[model samples]
Target: MAIVLTVRDSSGLKLAALATGFVMASLDVTVVNVAGSAIQQQLHASLSELTWIVDGYVLVFASLLMLAGGLANRFGARAVYLAGMAVFFAASLACALAPTAGVLIAARLVQGAGAALFMPSSLSLLVFSFPDKRQRTRMLGLWSAIVATSAALGPTLGGLLVSAFSWPSIFLLNLPIGVAGILLTRRCIPPVGGRRVRLAVPGHVLWIAALAALSFALIEGPRLGWLARPVLAAYVVLGFAAAALVTRERRAEHVVMPWNLFRGAGFTGANLVGFAFNFAVYGGMFMLSLYFQHARGAGPFLAGLELLPMTIWFPLGNLVYSRIAGRIPNGVLLTVFLLVAGVASLAMAGMSTDTPYWVLAVAVAVANVGAGIISPGMTAALVEFAGVAHANVAGAVLNANRQIGTLVGVAAMSVVLGTVTDWNRGPGLSFLLLGGAYLAGAAGAWWLIARSERQARNVRR
Candidate 1:
């Protein structure tokens, strides 16, 4: 028997959808990052293999995201999103029971693809559903809050699961969430028709290959010698091939990131900032956990407890910002936040076992406070300028940028650590990498806003 439910108000139902998908995606992103070592030990993965364990999913997530949005457009956002949730739950089972590093990495790759599919449409549904600008912005703010909380709490949750059960338990956690999401989705998300089209399969293959090559080169380059003929050649060839793929995509009637991605300086600038922010953010969390648990000898539960400040404070920061959202200029708020966060992170490079717990708490809190200020405002700017027709696709682009940013951040930090088990030195390097990345993020905020102002005037036409 089929049961039907009416969404009394699409706004509330959409918000519920946003909250569900954001938290689920954010949890997967952060938890796996924290559980790296547990999986590494159990699987006996080499440092190179372990690097892929993290970067592999991020890369595929970014790569397929171009396609995910298109699929949503061609096949109804609700259908694609529901399918993604199903795939995510099934992949979680594979991740939990994997006997080999190869299997885990493969499972993680599918998981990333599912995440890519789930996130964009869920967010797009929010964007299109909320008709008023103020309501839309606030809904996104609420959406941002959920994602930020999950991201902040991921380490703690990962630690708890790893400690209470085992490393595989981290992946196991997704099943119930998926089941719940499916039920909620059925009730809240309206069914809609989809566009009809043939895929740009050749271009898709080219980009996927490019992503795989680029991921491998970047992960291996630092350790294997970046200047080595083989490494340099791989990067050079991959770069050219990727360029060719873009050109081919541009000429296709059905382009992914149409050449119009460079519509103006504002779009380009905002996109760049999104990238830099993610680059350092994801890796920084992973590296810090390694420092706390592996280096400081803190138990998983204890380590999670230590990380509670970021989780608790992040939502609070959003709550504060939600109160004063429209009053503040998006650019000004973002710049100050990123600058302060960057400085605080750089300060974290000096933390030690002898350091006071209050000091660590302050550092994490400061960074998250900045995250609350910048995230909603930045996303708002991007969506406001992107327009509804392209909303799903533009949001997909943002999702890819954010994931890639995380991959780069993690990769940069890993290179600094050189696969050593030393915890004392890891934090310092992680801090430096994140600090530099945030500084770049701060610059991105300024550029993004400047461009958005012009875009706003143009859109009024």
Candidate 2:
């Protein structure tokens, strides 16, 4: 009994350390949204520049995630995790002191690189810490709740800080969180040994190039004109780099991505679900943040308050997941959640600039609850499918895809905002796009995940 108590206490401390890292990472993702207006005013940034400020982090983070996972496998996960925390801490400081929009974007890119390194390792550590399937599912739910809470609080916290101080305060907030994460990680989490895994450098480089070109085309298309020479050239580059990367990875002796893992339809579906989930959730959040300030003429503090109704339900959904996780099939749960979110988002498509706050708020709150449930449910399903052997690589793939979704989602919103001069039409259109993404995820979950589960059960019979 004494030994059991000691083990449980140790696991609790380890969880705390992991949660700190997640808080910092997730906080940055949403907190910066509320600071958009403030950052724009102070930096005198253009719409494109503002979009860059947001996407720069996601772009680098998404591009490097697979490499980071490979590195974690090659080097020890603990070492890589600590290194990432240190880098993120320094980058946050640079972001806080950025003199120009360009400087801030650069710092954000560095911050993303750090996040890519740590994020996958954090999941791997959590999986290893709780080896039992039941206990791991519970911990995953708890971890999701912690992350959701931080993200849900981001806008409100950023608003309060920006109103009281300035936009820089949002970045400054990460400093303490970073310090706590590093110290606690060192003291609590046990070190996992490294393996001799090969890093596919060429494949990674091509992958990065492809994503960069695509982002350039998407973010710059509206400003440059879709037919502009630079935009056209970027499109060409994007196509070439993507094709080359795919070919290279297919033939590589040692691949960066675990292709074998993706052979399972369940795994593929989970990745798709993760991608669509981020696309809708992050994209919708960005649009609504701007809508509150730019369309509704709200101040930073007011904007944050307005966003609270939409974001606060995420933690509640995560808590609900913990109770129903094992009772329901993951595929069925995901399908239902996606459907709820999709329908709710579609309801928001009718919203105009003059729409009542409560109306929009209720719609968003319902959508958020569904999104919140999907996050942990999808994660738990993917982890179960991947098993412990491929935990690091699998985690990286899911997160990378999700970040890619976020990058594309935000870029898509920028296109809508830039192209449509009318705030009323633009926001409604954005909601439509978000709705489509969610519904698409639901379809994939039903087709791939449910079918796979049925096949497995049939085999057992």
Candidate 3:
């Protein structure tokens, strides 16, 4: 019994280290938001420049994810993880000292390249670390908990960093964490070697250009007016280019996303559910943070703190539900979680500048719990639905869907949230519109999960 306990404890510790790696990579996902103005002032960035600073990183990170995993397999996990941290640290330093917004955005893209290197490897490492079904489920749950908490807490942390130090302090903060993580990674991780394939250069170039142009168009379209000639032109060119890229990949010797992963209904269903889940969460948070500041008269730090319930309750929910995961019906669990979160979002729609703080807190807390349940459930389902060999690509596909969902949410918000902005009600009607969308996301999850379970059964047979 004591020996068993020691093994379990060691597994848990490794999990902590791995999960922290994930959180560190993800911090960049939102930390820049609160510090955007500071970077702008420090670097003398323009409005367009500031927009690219954030969007560039996201586009690179999203596009290169699958490619990074292939790199990992060709190289080794530990090497890739360490290289990523080094690149991340180097890029962060360059970003801090960058003299212009264009330069800063370029540095940030390098940073994102590092992040793409790290993100898929982190998940792959976790799946490799714990082989037991029960422990794997639990660890994945813990991992998701940390991710959700980080998103909710990032602006708060960024606010504190920016408040006390300069905007550069935010990126500088990664040095110690990266250094420590790298040391731990080298010490603890055993070297696992496999294949060494050549990088698919043409595929990389095509996809990167496609993703960059596509993300640019989506993020810029609202500000530029969707029908603007440049935006329309960009949309047209990228659309055709992407189709061509897909056709080319179908015949490539080393393809990034194999054509048939989606042939399994389980993979398809899981990806759909994953995309919608992240879409609803990220979109809701984007809207809610604005509401807290613009509608409720809160500062960035205060608004982040106001959402503290989301940070605290998510892990708690993940721990509880994951323990009972298999016993409960998968379809019922996902459906209930989404329904509860959507309903909580609807409740939040009624909040105003004068609403009780505690009421707002509880609504977000409930939403967090629902999100907590959905994340691990979705991740585990996707991995299990795909065979072990394809887990890396499965992660990539899941991430792509996640970004797609976010894009869709962003587009919808930009289009419809204008009503509130036009009325000078800033966050009021925006919250209601987002709430309705969250409900729609819940419906999507329900439908896809039903489809997923049926597919799982068919595969088993």
Candidate 4:
């Protein structure tokens, strides 16, 4: 009994260490939304520059995640995780001390690279630490809860920090978290052995180039005009890079992406769900944060407070998922949660500047609850499909798709905001887009996931 208790306590510590990395990463994703206006005003940044500041980290993070997974497989997860945390710590300091928008954006890109390194390895470590399926699922739930809590706190905390100090305070918040994560990880998590894996360098380079071109086209198109030479060139570059990436991926001996993973219907569907989920949730969050501050004339602190009702439900939803995860089929759960989010988001599409705050809050809260549940559900589905052998690669693929969704979502919202000019119309239209993304996820879940589960059950019978 004593030995069992000791094992459980040790596992708990390992879980905490893993959660720390996610908490910092998830916090940065949302916290920057609240800090957008502040960063813009302080840096004297244009709207496009502000978008770059936000997307720069995600762009790099998304691009390198698959490579990070390969690195973990080659160099051992523990070593790679530690290295990533150290990089993140240094980059966070650079971000906080950045003197201008260009410097901040550059630092953010580096910070994203660090996050990419740690993010996939953290999951690989978690899967290693909890070998039992039931235990791992439970830990995944708790992990999601902890990370969701940080995401929930991000905007409010950023608001308070920005209100009291400055925009850089948000980046500075990561310093202590990074230090604690590194220390706890070193103390609690045991090292995992690496296998021989080929790291495809050229494939990753093409991937980065493709994403950069796409980002430049999406972000700069509004400011520079879609027909501008640079914008046109970026589109052309994006097309060429994407074609080259596909061709290389097909021919590469060592591919960054594990193309074989998508062979399972469940895996393909789960990736689709991941992409749409992030597209809607992160994009909607970005839109709402700006709407509260720029449209409703709320200060940073007030905007944070106003967002509290919407953000707080994420943890609650995670807790609810933990309770019901075993009882319900993942496919059913995913479908229902996504439908709830989609309908709620669509309901918000009619909102005007004069719409009742409570009404908007209620709808957003519902959508958020659905989103929160979808996060763990989607993760568990993908992980189960991949099994232990492919855990790291599966995690990387899901996260890369999600981050790409994030990049596109934010850029799409930027386009909406830029083109519409009217704050009221822009946010409503943004919700419309969010709703469509969620519905698309629901369709994927229902068609692919549900059918796959049925077929599997029939085979067993």
Question: How many collisions per candidate?
Answer: 3, 0, 0, 0
Better of 2 and 3 by lDDT: 2
| Pairs of residues clashing in candidate 4 | none
How displaced is residue 273 in candidate 3, in Å?
Answer: 2.4
Off by over 4 Å in 3: 1-9, 37-50, 294-297, 346-362, 407-429, 454-461
Which stretches in model 1 have alpha-carbon errors above 4 Å? 1-10, 227-233, 349-357, 419-426, 454-461
Candidate 4 lDDT over 62-100, as tens digits, reads 999999999998888888899989998899999999999
- lDDT of each structure? 0.76, 0.89, 0.68, 0.89
Error of 4 at 388 (Å): 1.1
lDDT of 2 at 197: 74
Question: RMSD for each model, in Å, please?
Answer: 3.5, 2.6, 4.3, 2.7
* Greater-TM-score candidate between 1 and 4: 4
* lDDT: worst 10-residue window of model 1: 1-10
Clash pairs for candidate 1: 278-405, 279-405, 279-409
Candidate 4 at 146: error in angstroms?
A: 0.3
Candidate 2 Cα outliers beyond 4 Å, as residue runs: 1-9
